[model samples]
Target: MRKLIIGITGASGACYGIRALQMLREIEDVQTHLVISPSGMRTALEEGTGLSGEDIRALADVCHHHKDIGASIASGSFRADGMLVAPCSIKTLSGIAHCYADDLMTRAADVCLKERRRVVLMVRETPLHAGHITLMDQATRSGAIIMPPVPGFYTQPKTIEDLVTQTVGRALDLFDIDHPSVRRWKKECATEA
Candidate 1:
């Protein structure tokens, strides 16, 4: 099975993390291991994901406690194909860049880097300062892919949902998922038959 580790931090846009989990669950070939920050749980509930271990379980194959550094996903020997930190907060980004594995999410990211596997940071922040930009740079220099949740409008998306799907689709593309997660505007099709 193709395994991926996903981390959700207590960032403002919980929808991104929830949507990513939902989409990952739809991939039969992908087995997901999840870790959620304590704040993430609150955000998930407040943002209407219903917030419980069961909710996390329904989204991913396995859910590890935030403090469980001893989890299988924390070891390079487990050999995951990649790690995704969806809706990653700036704090989480800083922690991961500095190798501060105080939480399972950061530790899992650290493990992926050490194992030379893909690490995608769906960093959810805007109007970033130089320090924030530097953290992203350090992570990329360490072989991690820095992906912010910035969406595009060339497609003239009819709804906000469409916008969200586009970002998720692009993220999935980085992992090279065989499935198309969202629709793209084909020039010919946009012009009609």
Candidate 2:
């Protein structure tokens, strides 16, 4: 089984985390370990993730507390296939960049790096500065994929749900997990022609 860790940080776009979890739930081969940062919890409440922590826990095959640094997911020996921090905030990004394992989320990210597992950071921020770029560069150097949640115009999405699905689908693709939300680009059908 592919053991995956999905961390929800306190980024403005809480929907991405929720959507990612929803997608992960469909993969039979994937066993997920979920951890939500304190700030993410507040964001989840503010934005209303539409599901409670318990609800999320049930969606995931395995869940871990964010503050539980002693959790098995926090150890490199646990052998996670990858870790994804969707809606990763600037603070959390910097924390991971500096190897600040103050919490289980960061610790698990650190473990992902040390263990050479794929770590995808879905950062949701704009108006970047030098510090943000530097932190991102540092994390990438340490073997983390920084995927900013910048929506594209090519798809010409008609609804917020479309945009969310595309982003979440892309994240899942990184881990080779199949999600139906994403519309894989294909040539126009004869009906459209």
Candidate 3:
């Protein structure tokens, strides 16, 4: 069974995390472990996700509290294939970059880096300044992938849902998890040619 640790920070794009969780549920033999920051829950509700915080938690096979620093995922010994910080807030990125285990989300991310596991951060910020760029550099040097969920216009998405699905699918691709909904550019180009 492939074990994946998912962290949802207090960023604006809660949909990325929620969509990832929803898609992962359909994949057999893949177990999803989730952790949501306090602000993340608030954002989910405030953004009108149509699901209560508890309902969102139910999508995962296991859920860890953001305050639970002693959770299994916080330890390096707990083996996981990878970790994804979807909608990674700049605050969380700073914490992970500095190796500060102040919260469970950062702690688990730290553990993943130390364990030589893949860590993908779907950072949700724009108009980047020097500080954000520096932290991203630091995180990348520590073996984390800074993946901002930018939409692909070539897919010619007609709805917001299509863009969200494509972004989430690409994030999952980093873990080599195949999401059927992803519209591959190569395939589309090939068909066009």
Highest TM-score among the candidates is held by which one? 3
Question: Per-residue lDDT for 38-75 in model 3, tens only?
Answer: 99999999999999988999999999989999899988
What's the candidate order when arranged by decreasing lDDT? 3, 2, 1
Candidate 2 lDDT over 1-193, as tens digits, reads 8888988888898788888888877877788888988788788878966777677568777778888999999887897889989889988899899999898988999999998889999987888999999999999999999999877767889998789889888888888887866777777657744
Task: Provide the clash count, candidate 3.
Answer: 0
Error of 3 at 154 (Å): 1.4
lDDT of 2 at 157: 96
What do the candidate models score in CA lDDT, each in turn?
0.84, 0.86, 0.94
Model 2 alpha-carbon drift over 4 Å, by segment: 187-193
Clashing pairs in 2: none
Model 1 agreement with the true structure over 1-193: per-residue lDDT tens digits: 9998888898877777777788887889899888888898888778775557576657888889989989998888897989988889999999888988887899999999988899999988888999999999988888889888888888678877777777877887788874565766576535545
Task: Point out where model 1 deviates above 4 Å.
Answer: 49-53, 185-193
lDDT of model 1 at position 64: 91
